[model samples]
Target: MNKQLSWLRLAATLVTGALAATGALAEDGPQAEAGSAPPEASAASAARHCVAELAPVNAGARTSAIKQGGCYSSFAAAMAAATDNTVALASESSPESVGESDLAAAATRVIGIDYDGRFYSGSSFIWYARNNFGCFGGRSYTANMPGSFNNRLTSTRGFNGCTRNTSYSGFFQTGFWVRCFPNCLYIGDFMNNQTSSKRWAR
Candidate 1:
């Protein structure tokens, strides 16, 4: 019985050592797969608000960009769907037609969009003004980058009346300000990957 007990202890020790080694290897392994967002970015993307796509010619025709039965858990995945036109509206709402005036009005609500890659090639974040009221009449839009997105902006586009963008190197619109009027296909070296907060105005 003593010999059997010793054998059992040896087996348990071996198993524990193997598990520890495996865990160490996993910790030292590659953090993420190629072309995949980091775990923190994926989590941030899932936590953000869902995005909707508007028709290029007629913005009033909106479609949900989120997948059916599940939210987009990765910004890259969401951008892929947006680029490939694979997104569909929720089941409760079908596509609808709108008047020309409505389309024109709808087009002016989009304020800005930030991208993680140059020329808008990666994960994207968009901003919209409430009730189509853009940054005008002393109204402005501002926000600090989320934890995962901080220092991640590489490009940006501004539309409607919020064509003036001011990027800051610190949160709360502090630090050196880099101004990009209208749009920036690539935020220059001074501001690229250094933007922690931003503001948009007419």
Candidate 2:
């Protein structure tokens, strides 16, 4: 009888030990596995990723000479370098429409990027590619923009306004995202890469 009792206790202890081991493993599984990159790393990586994924324009209206400015690894770095009349690009949205030769012409165009669908007037800056590119400020508030972070957005307003709404064909939308406004509207979906913006009003 005592032997049987001893056997039963040993079995229980073994089962308990196995369960405890499993619980511990479960608790540490995520921590042990790879996690999201650091914030600074993520931001830098976004721009790099976008630039790396730049697809060549096969057949359509395209610009030229979009040089890879000093690839700033961080938004702080990009912001420090960001000036008025600069343009941002990303993996999701790149300079396919604007070619290498068109770089000069495209440079004058403040092609900001809007990764997410959010903006505020006269507060946020423009985002060309979420983490991909951080370009110049559209309006007089170029110096009032925020540091690029997570390749998301840096503006409180939708975006700078466009000069004219010139409609084109071939490409449905500009690969990148953007926002526009006559009375301050978020039109990144319908108006991205489709029109010319002036200030962050677009």
Top TM-score prediction, candidate number = 1
**Candidate 2 Cα lDDT to native:** 0.34
For all predicted structures, in order, the TM-scores are 0.51, 0.34
Cα lDDT, all candidates: 0.58, 0.34
Per-residue error for 176 in candidate 2, Å, reads 14
RMSD of 1: 11.8
In candidate 2, what are the lDDT values of residues 129-161, reduced to their tens digit? Answer: 222222323222111112232333322222123
Off by over 4 Å in 1: 1-108
Give the per-residue lDDT digits (tens) of candidate 1, residues 1-202: 9999999999999999999999888777775345688888675444432233332212232221212211254543332343343323333221121112322335335556676778754555655443455565555666666665789888877666666877889986889878788678789988889988877777
Model 1 residue 91 CA deviation in Å? 16
Q: Give the TM-score of candidate 1.
A: 0.51
| Deviation in Å, model 2, residue 53 alpha carbon | 18
